[model samples]
Target: MKQDVQPLIVNVKRYTLVRNLVFGWLTVVLFAGFLLNFPKINILEHTARNLYFHVPMWFTMMAAAFVSGYHSLKVLQTGDPLRDIRALQAARIGTFFGILGLSTGIVWSRFTWYVGTDVWWNFDPRQIMVSIQLLIYGGYFVLRSAFDEPNRRAKISAVFNLFAMTALPFLLYVIPRQMESLHPGAEGNPAFSQITHPVMRLVFYPAIIGFIGLFWVLYTQRVRVAWLKYRVTQDSEM
Candidate 1:
């Protein structure tokens, strides 16, 4: 007799209330901090409100990319095709959040630049490289779907994902510092200003945590859905 394997369940029911309580408390603290301290920033003033959404978007993007790279590494080591699918979903979702982050940052820029002071888009190397990073993953999805052979798709994507992960550090940190820009922390900029404010920290930290948690939830769901579909297709073929 053949043994039946159970599908994975991606839930933590025992800690449901605890997680909710923590998330609620953090959300309240972030909102309160933002309400109280937002006026102090001269650059954006009221427009600084974008920080709540903008920063969180970036955090989620990083989380997604990290998850993608992790699964890619696992697939390479273990030769598990499911891990490759999970990694692809992470890249797809992460890119969505990255684009959202870029859009929100641009809106904030427009408010600060005060119209006509600069172009709508700049040729900054960081921006250009990050955009290319986005396209690289976009092509990844297309390439994966183009092949009917699971083994070939997984191997090719794993190699490409490893290469793409290297660009992340450059795009997120290094290249930004090399150029002049309207964005903060540019051109050898060093300031404790953003990180040191207690009120801002209250909001920023939770926002980061909340966004990361949210990404995990979404990624888990995507994997479950894809796994189910894969099982169904296999059954029908049999």
Candidate 2:
């Protein structure tokens, strides 16, 4: 019992350190995001501010998916129930970021490109592919609930989580770029760096790091809580 409790103690200490650091870092990013000056392009003008907020959401989602995939791989190797918990938490958080990314993109696009029109969604390739990606992860959560046995659920869900991770990059980046898209890096559109001002990159990079750190903090908290519940109930679903 002491051995088990000891690991939890160490985890708590580490989590506390990271949580505080991420909070401070993100606070700074938020301030810089709004306060810093950016070059105004036609159409994008003020909405260019979204580069710091919107782009980071997808970056955070990618980071979360990577973390989830690593844990899922561990689950396959060690059959550790805790790995399943981590995978689930990471995927859930990743999905949250995906949703934010989609929402922000819609708002940004509506005002910038569809100002005179009533279009909220134009069925852009990136938008369609990302929506499908989110649905794939949605299936992962739903699949977990179908099994009553803990080990079986963990094993099966871990497999599905891996598949979801595999599909992420292609759906979010590759396929979207292959067809016509208003988004940067897509067919005929300039890549991000080509259109974005150098000054914006300063905030953009840190914003990515800050959002990913935020994801880690949230994911770790959920894992700790779920672990506690699992220990007490001997059930991995919390």
TM-score of candidate 2 versus the correct structure, residues matched by position: 0.96
Error of 1 at 148 (Å): 1.6
Candidate 1, 126-205: lDDT as tens digits: 56766877887777777777777777778878878877776776787677767775556777555437534565665767
The residue ranges of model 2 lying beyond 4 angstroms of the native Cα positions read 1-6
Tens digits of lDDT, candidate 2, 121-198: 999999999999999999999999999998889898999999999999999999999899999999999999798899
Best by TM-score: 2
After aligning candidate 2 to the native by TM-score, how far in Å is the CA of 90 from where it should be?
A: 0.5
lDDT against the true structure, per candidate, is 0.71, 0.91
In angstroms, how far off is 127's CA in candidate 2?
Answer: 0.5
**TM-score for every candidate vs. truth?**
0.84, 0.96
Q: How many backbone clashes does candidate 2 have?
A: 0
Best by lDDT: 2
Which portions of model 1 show Cα errors greater than 4 Å?
Answer: 1-5, 12-30, 116-119, 192-196, 234-238
